[model samples]
Target: MKEIDFSKLIVTLVQPLVQEPSAITVTERDTERYREYVLDVAATDVGRVIGRQGHVASALRTVVEGARNKHINAKKIRLVINDHRH
Candidate 1:
């Protein structure tokens, strides 16, 4: 899978866990230097995606990083969980 696939994966993973699956948004940013991914969850369901003790978020980062390594495009990638649950 490619970068966009990761975004889709986030949606797929979080959709069933939340009441409003449509509220999930995965935003990607690319620059000459690096690519950044931000997972945005609904204010009401942030806890679901994050899980307990940040384990879910860490797992997400690990998966994306592993995928990037396999693709080996020589790019720096950052996966971020931007909690907009305020």
Candidate 2:
């Protein structure tokens, strides 16, 4: 199986929804049971990314989860979104 560039995928998905594309950041972390992707967006753009009632976030997770299932055979994957605070 090919290695998935989850960080880049996440950035690509999130960039269009934010006011400052350059401020978006995606970090990956490995745990015992799951690989986590932490997506941090600008504080002002947090709501836009999250969407009303979390619909946008849910869709993002669904897509990433699908990619993991299709392209990788390893631990479960997680997507976490946060606001980058300065």
Candidate 3:
């Protein structure tokens, strides 16, 4: 299987769950110890992506962490969702 790009996948995962897909923006930053993915979405759609009780956000993080473990070594990756709708 062709390995997936977790950052891109993260963006794809969130785009559909949001109300304004065009407002969705993902930024990737790499550091010596970790890779950071910043997920930006409209405030109106923040609740939808985060889901009830944060289940959605947790799941998204889990998947990305899993993938990061498979590819990255001791280094790690993190997902940060930024909602600026309000």
Candidate 4:
């Protein structure tokens, strides 16, 4: 298991799908049960990241979770997408 930069990974995966690349932001919050990654994108790009029927978002979460599971860590990881009108 190696140190994984989940925030950077998310940003890299999402940057191309957004119109305002500079507005993309990823933040982390730690809880007793899990670590949460909050992804904020320009309001207009939200749909792009989410994709139709939320398939893209689901896929993104899958990738992130898969990586986390590969490492031997007790804490779980969560991905949250938020839209902002920056």
Provide the TM-score for each candidate, comma-separated: 0.75, 0.89, 0.78, 0.88
Q: What is residue 1's positional error in candidate 4, in angstroms? A: 3.2
- Computed on alpha carbons, the lDDT of every model, listed in order, comes to 0.76, 0.87, 0.80, 0.88
**Candidate order (TM-score):** 2, 4, 3, 1
What's the C-alpha lDDT at position 59 in model 4?
A: 95
List the candidate 4 regions with Cα displacement exceeding 4 Å.
Answer: 69-71, 84-86
Give the per-residue lDDT of model 1 (tens digit) for 24-43: 88898987877787878778
Best by lDDT: 4
Worst 10 residues of 3 by lDDT: 68-77
TM-score: model 1 vs. ground truth: 0.75
Candidate 1 structure lDDT: 0.76
lDDT tens per residue, model 2, 7-40: 9999999998989999888888999988999998
lDDT of 2: 0.87
Residue 56 alpha-carbon offset, candidate 1, angstroms? 0.7
After superposition, candidate 3 runs with Cα above 4 Å error: 1-3, 69-74
Which candidate number would show the highest TM-score if scored against the true structure? 2
Question: Model 1 clash pairs?
Answer: none
Per-residue lDDT of 4-62 in model 3, one digit per residue for the tens?
58767887888778779988878888888777888888778889988999999999998
